[model samples]
Target: MDLFEKAAILQYRHRRIGDPGRCVGWCSTDSQRLRFDVLCRVGDTSDSQTLATSVSTMCPSSSTKRAGAMVIFHAPDLCRPACCTPFFQMDYVLASGVLSYRCRNALYPYKAIRQMWEAATRGPGFNLLAANVFEASHVLCGQNQHAILAFSRTLDPAAELVTGSVTDDFTLLMRRRAA
Candidate 1:
């Protein structure tokens, strides 16, 4: 099944998201019904302490000033089985509700990040993160968890557009874009 399918099975235990095969994720403007797609897992990489730390640090649960998030994100790379990354890229559109997986390529290079970022920072405490997907120094594995973490830390402290990804250790890291 696809990512959206996984989410639907996870959230609603079904495989229909807006359409049949072209689904991405779920989207809703309603504040009462929030969806957690980025936090879901598909394989052996399940829940752990590191994951909790990652989500809390990267994704802002809520803001003291604002009410909720404009966007929450994760990318499966540009290759088949897109795999998972530690970079959490979210863009929030005020009062527009959330939208998810609309196509197989929905997670393609710089998809919804741009539109959401533009709308999110229109007010205070609004932030957008950006980061480059880099290869880790390890010669044995293709896992880029460490690479993503290091990349996130190197971002500008004021970088509202940081990239978030799953760590090599199965942790999630979403922060403001590095400089």
Candidate 2:
């Protein structure tokens, strides 16, 4: 990120909510709702299952399940899984900016996050992988869609955009390739 963006983020983090001129990050309630709506639309919430990493917005118990589609989340610090399992052999995975982006105090390289998600998609019985990544690094570095293509693991072009825009942080809906 550039000096201005860094400063803006710092200012926003330090100030209280509703403070003037401060922008909300990916974890904000409104932002979460926006991303969740996209997921619901694209994932065919009527019958498909979902597994998320975070606890607040996407957790199974906290959020309503649509049409009996099982929704499960695991976060050690905040909420425990309904089945008391850390990771499920689920078919669908939904990760927000937190999983792939350098948010809060956790930082990860673009390639690392990309590889991780790709591996998860390749897991047995996995079907859909949906996520939105922080786009500042990709945009600021002038890499165009190269970073996004890499993030989606486009080695064989399996992932596609289901919603949102690529100019900023956007969502991607990917399907696992049949083995």
Candidate 3:
């Protein structure tokens, strides 16, 4: 189908599933996903690209901005494996790099990020390292300061916790709802 068709379908799904169109997405493949079309950033790591998609200070805290600890979401053309590993790290740096957060490809138990901003001295990128061997289930990204959802046996997003995977349904939460 064409982009318009995909967009129409996405908007339909977003409204049905309860996600706002203001939600942006970025990936390294044509399947990154949005209510519109998919845009991938594979090789061109240009400064403009980084600036246009940086979520570093969308809802910034004083500490984060001061530290320049931007959580950049980088999605290559690879699908995240199932979120069942007790101890795993989505390393971004070559020798030893760890994402400020711990999440592989969000497509699995969570959803992927649409864009990012990185410093030159920081090297390539970051990784999503995680270790919860004691927990009996997999943890999903809940998109808030308390962004974690545990699943004991099923990865079904529709099961009380999730409406669907971030990749498929686009029911992702970049921020939390206020009380």
For candidate 2, which ten residues in a row score worst on lDDT?
123-132
lDDT of 1 by residue, 1-179 (tens): 36654454345313333442323222222211222233222111112111111111133233311342233232222121111222422222221112112234433212333322332222112111112332322111122334433433343233222223322122222333324
Candidate 3, residues 131-150: lDDT per residue as tens digits?
Answer: 22111112212232113233
TM-score of each: 0.23, 0.49, 0.20
Q: Which candidate leads the pack in TM-score?
A: 2
Q: How high is the lDDT of residue 164 in model 1?
A: 36
Q: What ranking emerges by lDDT with the best candidate at the front?
A: 2, 1, 3
Q: Once model 2 is optimally superposed onto the true structure by TM-score, how far is the C-alpha of residue 104 displaced, in angstroms?
A: 13
For residue 10, give model 1's deviation from the true position in Å. 8.8
Residues 57-156 of candidate 2: C-alpha lDDT, one tens digit per residue: 4423223454676665554222112222334445555554333322332223343334434444432111111233333442122222345555565543
Write the number of the candidate with greater lDDT, choosing between 1 and 2: 2
Angstrom error of the Cα, residue 53, model 1: value is 21
Provide the clashing-pair count of each candidate structure.
35, 0, 6
Candidate with best lDDT: 2
**What TM-score does candidate 2 reach?**
0.49
